[model samples]
Target: MLLQDKVVLITGGSQGIGAGAALGCAEHGAHVAINYHGNSADAEKVVAEVRKKGRRAIAVKGDVADASTATAFVKAAVQEFGKVDVFVSNAGICPFHSFLDMPQETLERTLKVNLHGAYYMTQAAANQMKDQGHGGSIVAISSISALVGGEYQTHYTPTKAGVHSLMQSCAIALGRYGIRCNSVMPGTIATSINKEDLAQPGKREYMEGRIPLGRLGRPDDVAGCVVFLASDLARYVTGASVLVDGGLFVNLQ
Candidate 1:
């Protein structure tokens, strides 16, 4: 149990990669605080599953994109668990549109949730970790799109690139307090968020063809990396961006 007795907070944890991280953390004996913005039922489901594994779990409802709500969510977790050992900033949104025709609001919202949310969440969690007098880990969920810009995903790319940049900067600023910061860049993962598009035969084939691994990634694939980074096993690692992209990012020319 690499994370035995640790406390983890995962934002946007009701589904996709976030939900997967909650479960993985629980499996490793970490008490998980699952935060969901608009999906209380799904969040509850994850909480139930975590409890079934004999670990403490709770569902917290809040919008990570908002500063006040992110602060409150961190407060609630600390109230229940005494302290936060790991904070995973995984809340994000992606709506694709051609760069030349993308709406201003679309771009703003993407930055708000993907980049600003990470900022607020990390700020809130880092404060708590600093007060606890023990070093902690903060993992941000970036995307391979940040490394290799995607067509029609210009807005998302910048936000994710900001995440990677944030990780490096935070690592340096927070190192004095024993806090570590890192980012995980995931490739095409099979999640409900993209099920509609991936269900189409042509789109599915095109996505799979780009991966050298010959298959799309799964949520657990990225979750596994998140858990490792959050564990003591990665105590000496910080300011790093680990790509769980199945070689897709490398294949980009």
Candidate 2:
């Protein structure tokens, strides 16, 4: 009941961390508006699960990389739910490529989706919250790679670092309006995007050995942090980067 009756919109919410956050919000009595660029079936499944929790839920479709589309989706959610109380800018792409052979196309696309998408969605959502005369929460899903550069994530990690900076800036710029902004940096979460890589022989064991928690993170690990930031309990917790990495990055440092 931490987010009772709050309206939350999550982009790329059909699967992985996004989907997990949507369900978590619903369980806490929040209405979820899930946005998915593709895979209508996955979106529908998430919507159904949210409804099963007896909370209002809807699935929206749009490419978050398009500023207009991202803005429109926020408006759509506001129109459906009356007003957005929370916005989770969780849509992003992570493609690992060594620095030497990283293609220009890959780098550009990663920046567009990971950084630009969050930028637009957050700006639009913040404007809506300001116009409504009530404060709201914004949680951007970043990565631990932002703190510790990965060997194969040269193109990817920069975008996440940008996301953290973006969150802090938004928090400062919008604090007067009672808006809160923060980022969640997840580490080695098991998601469809990285399942193949993590499932490589001996990979799981090696990763677990490194993490103090001795296991890979789950999507719900990040989702739980997002819900806390979205709730009034975190009212004084703006401009913070909540790490959900199970001590992987900390131990390394």
Candidate 3:
């Protein structure tokens, strides 16, 4: 009950890490607004699951990458829940390609969705939180690639790095208002984004060997860290990047 009676808005929350965060927040007694760009069915399922747990939940459809949509999504959440206590900027894309062979469109799309989207959503949510007079927490779902560049993920790495930077700046600028911002950098999580990479027979094994934990991370691993950051337990923590990479970044020599 660390987040009891809190209101949380999680972007890209229909599935994967976002979905996990929505569920985790709800389980801790937070009323959650699950935002999904597409896949309304999946979003509904998450809402249902949250309600089944005796918590209020809603599925909000909007593209976080667009400023208008992001603003609308935040507005809807505030309309339903009165005010937002936590905002999780988890919407992102990773269409990997070699640095030399990367397409401009792909790079732009990655930057827009991963970095710009987080910026707008955070602004909208922070504004609402400030008006409420209680302040709030902002969490961004970055990746370990922000710390250690990935070979075939050139475009994605930069966006994540940008997110990390954004979190630091926002934390500093908003601290006066009791608002906290932090980023979570996850490594090799078993999400649909990496389905193709892990589909190969030996690929999953190869990745597991690199991790000190001897296994790929799960969505819940990242979600747990996010929930903690959004809770009063982390009230004194801000402008930090929590690494949930199972030692992958540290072990890389």
lDDT of 1 by residue, 161-208 (tens): 999999999999999999999999999999886787688869989999
CA shift of 5, model 3, Å: 0.7
For model 3, residues 1-253, the per-residue Cα lDDT tens digits are 9899999999999999999999999889999998898888999999999999899988888877789977898888888988899999999989878899789999989989999999999999998888888989999998898988788898999899999999999999999999999999999999988999899999999999999999999999998999999999999999999999899988896
* lDDT for position 170 in model 2: 95
Model 3 residue 203 distance off true place after TM-score fit, in angstroms: 0.6
Q: Tell me each candidate's TM-score.
A: 0.97, 0.98, 0.98
What lDDT score is found at residue 161 in candidate 3? 97
Model 1 regions lying over 4 Å from their true place? none
Q: State the displacement of the C-alpha of residue 161, model 2, in Å, after optimal TM-score superposition.
A: 0.4
Residue 63 lDDT, candidate 3, scale 0-100: 77
